[model samples]
Every structure is written in C-alpha cells, then in structure tokens.
Target: MKNVIFLIIFLFCLNSYSQEFKNITIIKSDKTEIKTLGTFVYEDDLIKGIKTKKNNLLISFQDVNKVFINKETYLVKNYKFKKYLFLKIINGNLSLYKDKKNYYLENNELGLKNIKKDEKRLQFVFKTGEVSLFINKCKAATNELYNKRKSLILSNLKKIINIYNTCDTSSKIQFADEVIKESNRPKEKVKFGLSFGLMKLKTDYNQPFSIEGSDKNFTFVGGKVYIFSNIFQEKLDANLSIDYFFRKNYQINDIDYYIKNSTQFTKLTIGANYTINNISKLITPYFGISGGLLLSSNSSVKLISKYLDLPSRHYTLSNELIYNINVGSYIYLLNQKIDLIFEYQPKINTKLSDSINLHNNSSSFSSLSFKLSYIF
Candidate 1:
C-alpha cells in the first residue's frame, strides 16, 4: 500500500496540470488560415479560444475547413445528424476517418459508413474476413486481402484501410511492401519474466548476544512483469514483482533445537524503471526503486532459554513494509525479443526494524541482494 501511494504521487507530478492545445492551426471555410499559439480548449465541436478578437476567436464546427494538431488533421464532418470533428486517417477514392474512439468511412459516391470497433490492440484478435465482411462495399479491397484473411488486427488495421481507399493495382502493390516493414515496428507491450537472487542479512549488536546460528545468507525466487512506457521519455517504464524467502537461526550442540528466529516472508514490489539510453541497444542499463508490503508467517518469533529455563520471550513487529533499490543491465538477444538481466540492490529496506529493538538501540536487521532475470 505504501508502494502504491508513492507511485501515484510520482505519476501525478509528471503529467501536465491542464489539457490545453497550443500553437494549433485552424482553417476557415473561407480558406483563410489562423495559427493560434495561445492556449485553447476544444469541446462540444467548438474551439473555446473566446477572447478580444471581437467574435473571431470563438470557433464553431461550421466555420472550419480543417484543424491541425501536429501531424493529425481533423475535419468538421456530420455524424449521427450532428456536426463533429473527425480525424481523416486515409485519403483516396474512399476515405477513412476516426471520431473519438469510433471509425467512419466516407466517399462522394458511397455513403458514410461505420466500421465495427473491436480495438483490443492484440496481435491477431480479429480475422481479415471479419473486417472485409463488415466493409463488403469495397469488393476490390476485400478480394486483394482475402488471401491473408486470418492476420487482420488493430496493428495492421491501417494497412487494410489504406488498401480499401485505393483499389488500383499500383496502390495495392505498395501496401503489400509496407505491411512487411510494419511488422518490425516496436509497440507498447507487457513483458513477463522470472528472477532468482541471493539475500544477505546483517545484524548490528550493541552488546553481548545469546542466540546464534541465524542463517545470514539465503536464496529467494521471484517473477516480474514489465510494462513498456514513455512516461517522460521513450525508455521509462514501470514494473511489479513478488519474491519469497525463508530464514532461520538456531542454537546448535544442544539437546533441543533452540530456534533463535524463524521467518518465511513474501513481498510485493511496485516500482518504476528508467533505461539509461535507447532500449534498442545491445546492453541497456536501467535503475528503479520499489516499495511494498512484507507478509510473513511469523513476524514476531518466540524463543525459550534451555539452560536458564526462562519463560518464552517475543520480539516486536518493528515494521511490516519493504522497499528496495534496483540497478540492472539488459543483455538483449534474438532480435531484442529476449533479455538477460543482472541486478544489484544496495538496500532492501532500512533496518526492517521495529520500535522495541530500535528503542533500546541494541539491534538492527538489514539486507542487500543480487538477482538474475530472464525476460521474453
């Protein structure tokens, strides 16, 4: 829970305070162009830059020929008996457009038509025949794509739309070559992987200690999921991981196995990672910090003295959370589809200390770890 709060605060800081479009271009029906470098709000098919232009600043749907926001071009078109700003994505004899989350196709000869939106962005979520059948009005386009009926999806949806807009032989040949290159483009994806590492624990003793045989060194296993991101830049990302380990210490050369301490814990780590440089490179270095909960079968352990025959004593639950630092390098393989990772954590959490042990200023439990992971 602490980890979640920290992540939320970090993202909240990165996002801009407002969603305003500036330096946006607008073309009137009269063919006059205006470049409004001032901040403007767009909503309800109107550009609310209302100002001292004496009635020229407030822009309505009927007044625009086209509006440009960077490379995107939006035109005021009619949809469902109402005026709307639609982004034209493909232009040919038959044109394709997007209005918000929906897509519409239009042509002078053929009436406006809507395309069924099943945009999951999955690699192959839909079949070509499914889309071709939906837009059967374009027989030439369908016949050309009928051969690869099974490969149609959001990633290649543009290619199909481009082919439909141009039924000519030259355009068809051009799209065929373009589709091959599109396959290599990188996309935002969630990658899964596993990691195994060794944990090293240290104890700071202020005075003489009685209990012994605590396993200071142990191994832990974990799995991680990485979500590719461009939060601030291209290589920035966020990931989640879980790890489990067991540690115990006992007194030896005694009749009874006097256990000093025993703990089996599982932790959840939520964090962000930023690659040092371009991710396409052979060796990509990255660093991150994560904070999360520590769940243990036994947080406070009881110990009994054999020789003294004293009553059982219990340790206090100093802290119930965990956090760590991760610095790693990725060794890319098989065309960057796979990565072998090596990571080091200088600190897992401060002391993991409770108030009791810290109050007496006698003991401290701390750790540092190393891990190796395989991501594909």
Candidate 2:
C-alpha cells in the first residue's frame, strides 16, 4: 500500500510540473478576439493560467463556459458584452500588467465595466473581511467610472466583507495565480526612474546686421529605463537605468529683428543605484548617477527674409557628447507593488553644432519629471 501511494504521488507531481500551456482564443466582438498562450487549469470557482514562456500570469474572471480550438488547443471562456470581469484573488503574489485594459479576456462577457478609454481600475473582494480583490494590472472602464463608481466599488467590497465569515482558501490562492498569469505588463519592475513631461532650453546672441535679440528654443523629451531589485529580502535595493533624450528647438530672440533656428539630437546613458532601509512596506528614498555619450545631429538653419534669399536655409549634420545625474524617491500607492515616482536630472554637455563657434559651447541643463508606475 505504501509503495502504491508513493507511485501515485510521484506521478501527480510529475504531471503538474510537466504542465504545458495551451493557447486561449476569446471572441470579444465581431471584429476582435484575444489570443493567449499559457498553461491553464480549472478548479471549482477558479481558473488558473500562467505563461511561463513569457513569465506572465492571469487570474480572476472565475466563470468559464467552454474550451475549444481550431488548428490549436484554446481555453475559451464566455462573458457578457459589458460587465466588469472581476478577478477575485484570495492570497497570492504575481506579475503586474501595465495596462489593465489590455489584460482583458476576449469574450464580450469578460470585459471592463465601461467602454471609456481613460478609466482603468476596479476593486473586487473574495473573502468578506479576510481577503479583498486587488488588480495587478489595472484597467478602467472610463474616467467616469473612476469618478462616479469609486464609492460603489467601496460599498460593494465592504458589504461583501461584512457577509463572508471565513476566507475561501482554495479559490483565493487559485485566483491570485490566475491574476499573475493573465497580466500584460512588463515582467520586471523599474526603479530610480524619471520621465519628462517637457524639458526646454534656449541660447541666443545678437544677429549680424540688427539688434534683434536672437532667441532659441531647445525642447527635450526622454526618460530612464532601468530595473530595481530587493536585497536581504527587505532593507536594501538596487537600481540599473538607461537614460536617453531627444532634443529639438526653435528660437527668435532679439526684438529689433528675427533670427530663427532649429536642431535635433539624440543622447544615451547607463547607470546603477543602491538604496538602504528600503524594505519597510512604506515609501523609500534613493539616489543614483549615470554617465554616457551623447550623439547629436544638427539640422540646417534658414536665413529666410534676412541675408541671402537664394538658398535661404543652411543645414548641418553633426554630433556631440554629454554626462548625466539623477536623484529620486518611490511612493507606494495601492500597496508595495504600485508606485508614484518623481526625479530630477542635471546634465552637462557641449552643445551640438557643425564647426560654428557661434553654436559651439559647453553648458549645464536641468529638468524635473513625474511618473506613475506599478511593479509585479
């Protein structure tokens, strides 16, 4: 009897470990369908799926109607056209989705409650008071839902918690895994980050013939792409980032006359960061610096209505180098996984130009950016 039991257990373990993901096809509408490639399993009141190939997961949308396939095996589920697909998770951790709207199952039944693009988050509850429904990947039905339905979600969640006396152990754990598998966000979380709403620069001297203060405009758009990892399971953290910026501007300075010019360039940089006392389940502050080469190319300038009307504009293609630094903090929003970020960058570099001393000089530029981020 012992030998037989051991053999049965081993086989079950082997089968679960060897589990292969099948593709899921959802008919969202007459014009749309969703294709998912992941490992899927069914349990009472729960559907668990994971994409080991991509390291992604999805849970919640507990109700499934059919499993079918065309040329390939697909786990097909049915949903109503305009009801919110609430993923009720009991207790589990998984990957986060960047756009909750995109994490939706294809069937019309399992969709965001609203059709508005700007709205993207809903709260769900599973175990009355013991466990609550939280979104790893957030999607809003519309801005209206965020503004109007906030109270309804809170009320419903609270009421559900008041009724259930015990946690649904099996469903809760299973749903959490499902949430992770169905997520569409990046697999890794970014740290010590920065994003620019807008960065502007300017420089000018007097025109040759007139005192028209030559005005120039330098606008930059860029952000840091990096990864952050926790150390000692808590107190310490690390951040690695890549910084790049694209700059372009136009200027008309002097009141006496007009001197117009525009230029465009691209810059790249890489850096790493370290944080202390970071694992406290609260806000953590961090600092870091990065240095890299800046590659810039200049676009021709036009001297229209000023000097020569023949070839009114002059164009030059050139490149340059630069250095960068950053300091920032991470604030928790929904929990440890969701965050709001703010950072500052002060850069020093030789201006991009084509052998013109008038355009060649070294200066420091400064900027501040705010970003909202979520981690899985």
Candidate 2 regions off by >4 Å?
Answer: 1-196, 202-225, 229-249, 255-257, 276-280, 298-318, 336-352, 355-376
Give lDDT for model 2. Answer: 0.40
lDDT of each: 0.59, 0.40
Worst lDDT window (10 residues) for model 2?
A: 90-99
lDDT of 1 by residue, 246-350 (tens): 665533332532435565667787988777875666788888777777675354444445666554444543445666777777776766544334333332322
Best of the candidates, TM-score: 1
Against the hidden reference, what TM-scores do the models get?
0.41, 0.34
42-139: candidate 2 lDDT, tens digit per residue:
44322433333355666333343233334532233333432222232211232111122223212122232222222344444122211222321222
Per-residue lDDT of 210 in model 1: 43
Write down the TM-score for model 2.
Answer: 0.34
